[model samples]
Target: MVSAWETWVRRLVTRRPGVPAPAVAEATDPAGTRLVGAPEPVSRLLVVRPDTVALLTAAGTDPQLRRPGDLLVPPLLSPGAPPVTARAVSTAAVDLDVTVTDLLTFDGHAVDRAVLGVLVQLDDRDWYAELLELAAGHADDLEEYLLAAVHRELTTAVRGAVRMNRLADLQRLTLAAVLQDRWLPARLGAGTLRCLRTRVQRVRWPGEDEPTVPVRPPPAPAAPEPPPQPTGPDQSVPAGST
Candidate 1:
């Protein structure tokens, strides 16, 4: 089980099986993901991890997305694991920690680039059917598929807002407002992965500052512990007192 996680984790850190490593941030190379719906026929038993949910499908049945830490094995003395038809995929954490870099956005007349990062988590129950279908492409692993699908979502959302608004509007932080206003009510889940937070990493044009969306702030840092009181009492005698 440990080995399984180790192997998967290492792959998650890189772009692909034998590609040169890219500048990975919180999540390996989410922006660098190239494949989504690739063949992942499961033969041996698989132990799922906390960071991801597993997608599986057998003959004559609908595809299912299994939760994290789930063990995929035949029930006691079955022939073997069932066939997985569609390309498999994995789910990220519950907390919003996913990020994507470098996206192209349109501002009515001109096209601009805004490096966007988002924090997201998997929607355990409902994300199964819809998400897998959206991530149809070519990828060896599930995480790559997930990242690619998410990238598409963020890209679409940003582009849509930028297109309607003007450069002046974005400078006034309207882009952030538009995303929240529209996506929030509809539940921005590109492929069922819910949007938790968003940050403007940077913008192509000069003098354009990143804007903050309305979201929960990071937890306050824990207070420092005070120096321990002298233990075992008067062994060291109070200063100038007896």
Candidate 2:
């Protein structure tokens, strides 16, 4: 049966094939190495000495590292081995002390003897100090790029929100105006007629030469005449009545 340690090493190697086994050692070593932090996909490995910390790339090589600190230190495998240290004098070169520790610590992952065996086979090379300078500059550029991208996203969202709000407001105002117009009465001219008039009066037109004539009122009907007084009763009454 495969040991648990072997299985773990296999899994780690499979997950990140680009990461050399030695790099893993440097990452796991507690005394020799420490994980400063991982900013997303990039992991920063700090190689420490008695005095200062030397920053290494996530890939374990410092191509753009500063001068006098150009040497690459091999990973620690044995508990009894000496400790590893590095000194950077300029941007182009570096000096390092190599040591061994019984155990290493990295990002909470532990690597022991079996795992260290697979790591020591990897090689190390000196990286030019100018490479570190280039990397430093590139890091700044990346930050600016990311900041601009975030700004653009925020601006777009704000604009869309504003446009939607404006449309809703306009709709509300239009609805209000329509309701107001429907309920209000229309205005009328000064000479409009009413239905209850009992008379029709006519006035002469302006600038006419004819004298003004008064309109005549309809004549009152003559009072009904009273019947002729009855003839004296002495006279013989005629058969036909008047």
Candidate 3:
């Protein structure tokens, strides 16, 4: 009988004929080769060095980058490898030491602020709509307020007209007072007659003469000039005296 260890070893070694061999594992350096000599405490803005030209050239020629603004997620380089390749573009190259972290931070902040502003504006509009709806819902309150305002204005106007003596006795009726009494005509009979009398007094026939007041007659025309004082010389004896 086969031993357990032997059976296990046989099973591990056996393979299907059509199957391919497993891929070999390789050691990798995370830090790019070009940045191996880069200074510690890396700055936000790092200038491209001349030595990384080969890396940048390779990146520019990458087949995967077919469009503008496309980004290489993880750089295509090993530890100590230069990242010049990743920054290459068709028009102009980025010459700074911007890391993925920096890019994320910048984009995140901008997106957050824009989203927040839009949300705030929407919230304000919603609040305004709600307020309008509430006002509409309580229409009775609004009507009361409007009616009070109108009444107050009418009262003030009536008082002012009366004080200024600009109102006829009939016109002086206060709307508020009339409303309080259900708008009944004050003098269904006598008051109506008085109103009719007032109306009649205001009427006048076309071309009717108005009462005329005495006007002083214009001064009589000045006496006609004395027949031109004998034109040539002053014949009057007074001329010699003067």
The candidate that achieves the highest lDDT relative to the unseen native structure: 1
TM agreement with the true structure for every prediction: 0.48, 0.18, 0.14
**Model 1: CA > 4 A from native:** 1-42, 74-77, 80-90, 94-111, 126-149, 181-190, 206-242
Query: Which regions in candidate 2 have their CA more than 4 angstroms from the true location?
Result: 1-138, 167-242
Compose the digit string of candidate 1's lDDT tens values, residues 1-242.
Answer: 33565354333223323321121111233333322223444544655544455555566555566655566664333655455533324344222222333433354445446555455555545556665564343223455445545555666676667666777767777556666777532334444666666666556554445666889889999999998887775677668996
Can you write out model 3's per-residue Cα lDDT over 168-238, one digit (the tens) per residue? 32234432232233322221111111111001112121233555898999999999887865577766786
lDDT of each: 0.49, 0.27, 0.24
- The regions of model 3 sitting more than 4 angstroms off are 1-140, 166-242
lDDT of 2 by residue, 33-138 (tens): 2111121121223333222224334343432232222334443533443433332211111111111112222222221211111111101123423324433434
Clashing pairs in 1: 35-138, 36-138, 37-137
Q: How close is candidate 3 to the true structure, as a TM-score?
A: 0.14
- Of the candidates numbered 1 and 2, which has the greater lDDT value? 1
